[model samples]
Target: MATATRRSSRLSSLAESISSSAGSTQTPNSRKRKQSPVATPSTPPQKRQRPAKLPAATPTPSAVGLMAHATSATKKPTNPMVARLADPQTTNATLLSPETSRVITHMNVAAIPSRLPQPSTTTATLLEEANAHLIKVDERMRPLVENNFCRVFSPEGLAEAIDPFESLASGIISQQVSGAAAKSIKAKFVALFEGDRRFPHPSDVAPLPIERLRTAGLSQRKAEYIKGLAEKFVSGELSAQMLNDARYEEVLRHLIAVRGLGKWSVEMFACFGLKRMDVFSLGDLGVQRGMAAFVGKDVAKLKNKGGKWKYMSEKEMLELSEKFAPYRSLFMWYMWRVEETDISTME
Candidate 1:
């Protein structure tokens, strides 16, 4: 009985110790549970409500309204060409603004530099090679040649007519005028020299009065241009020998110095007058029109404004013409022919 009583008492003590320890551990956890319910209800609801308001604040606007706002906030164009067109000098300003014209003119000069490879093919060899190349690149040229409708031939008489002065005078006379009118003016100009000369020698012309030159249907500006060209010849700044001997670019440097002889004018003189095989002019209207027609697209539909067609950019035109290097002048002549007889009919 004594042993059994001792065992029962020890068991009762162990149960009491376990029950106390359990109560101690439960006390802090019960307190935390009470606080968390209140805190979570306040903070959790506030966080959810803030996010809901953010989505509501972002109102979706129409595309047109957004575009209008963007346009109004934007600055005006800084490009000189665009600015000139938008606010032209005169109300009756044509499609090409003066500033745009100047920019394009300079752009052509820079893009298509007056440089070409030395003419390697002789007059005898030029025909065969040029014809072969042309036929290979454009088969349309073959039928015309075969039918005798056109002939691709090299220009003659370069060495005999190396007089830069007379050539520059011709260029000045041809400016902004029709070919027939330019020829008429040139005839009148040649007649002024007297002695039944084919054209006025620089020595005879350099001494003539500006008014005397005006009789040749030349504007006062054109008269001045011719007189200046004559003076250069007389002063030996421009010599026929230099023109004959100089490289293509050197010739350009001397000729371009004369006020009225632009790059296009010099190129024409080089290609046709001097019979240079490699000369080209990206700025020439005939060349541009011919290229557009050759490509089977009307230039009038390209980058048009105010019912006028803008010329192709110099880089684009030069890129097209680059394949004909060292014999481009012949190709240019052919292009002019293509323009005259529509390219579509050639095939």
Candidate 2:
């Protein structure tokens, strides 16, 4: 009986060992356990492979340089929406909306300058170049600028004509709209004109039926305003060169004297059309906004209280532009761009 009991105990131990071995070798009974990638969540997931990495972003280049290259390089924009879109690398760059893509492709990204003063370049060397560029942006832009204003200009020459026309146009559109809304609408306008106009000549523009101009996304009044200017140019009432030939103040005075021409409008014509350095139209909201932005504030109530902008009087805006000197027009242009436009302009 004692021998029989020992053999039974030994058999029980052997059975227990066999059961443990079978359980360790076998798969789980559940279907999920059998098929799941990892039986349970023990680690974070790895990202799926992407097709490719995006091109590394470049340091902001000068808008003037970009425009000089882009405008001269192609008759039509490669991507028209890029100018009005937000920066691709910015936190806010990730966005949704039908117009978002359009904004990134249709606008003139070259309109604004991106570079600033760097050790490799100097104020004097860039001054001459900026001065010359200023002359081309607008005639009145010349008056608000100075011949000797090379100091501020060259170091910050890229600021000279950054966003030249688009910025002015943005200011025109942004009177009461949010920056995003203004950009969306502005993209439509740029897409319509730059794409469809095919560099409409002054005469071609003058007689464009109001409907045709409107189709290009301009409001009736704006269309008329542009047409009226065109007609004036075609007729002897106004000559575009008159602004070029006249002194800076004379240019401003003459431009502002036009019935529809205001300080802001004249400033744009000067900054963009003429490429004047050191221009700041106090009447412009974008200038005000840019001023606030430069000072690092979001519409501070004490704007006037701070002496920084105040010290830059109407004349000083020109003089301070001189500190930026010949690059004033570029500065005005880029700052204007910052108000409502972006580098994503498609072309």
Candidate 3:
């Protein structure tokens, strides 16, 4: 009985200890038992880092009254493309305010230097060759060719590059008419045909009735001249290629054989149109005057000094051209332009 009582007393002591420990683990005021205090790390409690402050979003007003008032005051958007085109000078005024347009007067100018596209191979070669000839004449015939025509003539480009077929036709039309009258008649002729086809092929132009052409614009005589030349071209009697290779004298002889085609017409064709360099038609009055002006002497005195050929005759022109050699055509252009200038100044 003593041993059993001792074991019962030990059991009661162990039960009492477990109950007290369980009571401590509960909340002190309310819970039946308390929880043990958990041991934390020795490091201080890590405070969570607050996210970096962000920009606050605009608050949408919940009041319907406020939103309705704002919507009523809003302006409609303008057509921006229409606005840009309507004010074409907008780019110029980028530095200025539209409200201050009336006050702005000075313009800002921007300048850039640009080169034209490179020329084709054929054109470049032709220019180089033509320039070589011009330079040769410039070296040898400096006094006559380059002095006066120095400003007017160019080897690589023409004064009339387009269908300036009319230059020859113009001299024909300008034969007796005043230049102004000839130009007016020419304008009518141009309008009668379309812009570029005014100078159609000879065979094509020849079939048209002469009177019809005159009514369109040419005079009876100019019409006759053009018709005669056209018929000649159609018949192969006066091929233009004659000027390319024939002796200067032979070409002139053949041209003058035609009723109305004079030495001057032939000269103009050979020199300016065909770009023949050997021609100098002394039968032309301008040539006479230009020669006289060059030496600062009287054409009358020049005529008197005649030995074999020294005046404004075909023979004399040839001799003078021999001295000027390779550049007579260039001299002719300048002579004409110079005469026009003198005439203008005198008038």
Q: Which number leads on lDDT?
A: 1
What's the best-to-worst order under TM-score?
1, 3, 2
- Write candidate 3's Cα lDDT for 128-197 as tens digits: 3333554564453344344543311232222112121233344555554444665577667656555443
Lowest lDDT 10-residue stretch of candidate 2: 87-96
Q: Flag regions of model 1 displaced more than 4 Å.
A: 1-120, 137-152, 155-164, 176-188, 194-196, 215-217, 296-303, 306-313, 341-347
Instruction: Show the colliding residue pairs in model 3.
Output: 25-33, 25-34, 25-35, 26-33, 26-34
lDDT of 3 at 181: 66
Off by over 4 Å in 3: 1-153, 158-167, 193-198, 296-320, 332-347
User: Candidate 2 residues 46-65, lDDT tens each?
Assistant: 55543242221110112212
List model 1 lDDT by residue over 235-284, tens digit each: 87876555544677887888878876655556555554445567776655
Assess each prediction's global lDDT (C-alpha) against the native: 0.49, 0.39, 0.41
The TM-score that candidate 1 achieves is 0.53
State residue 13's C-alpha deviation in candidate 1, in Å.
99
Question: Which candidate, 1 or 3, has the higher lDDT?
Answer: 1
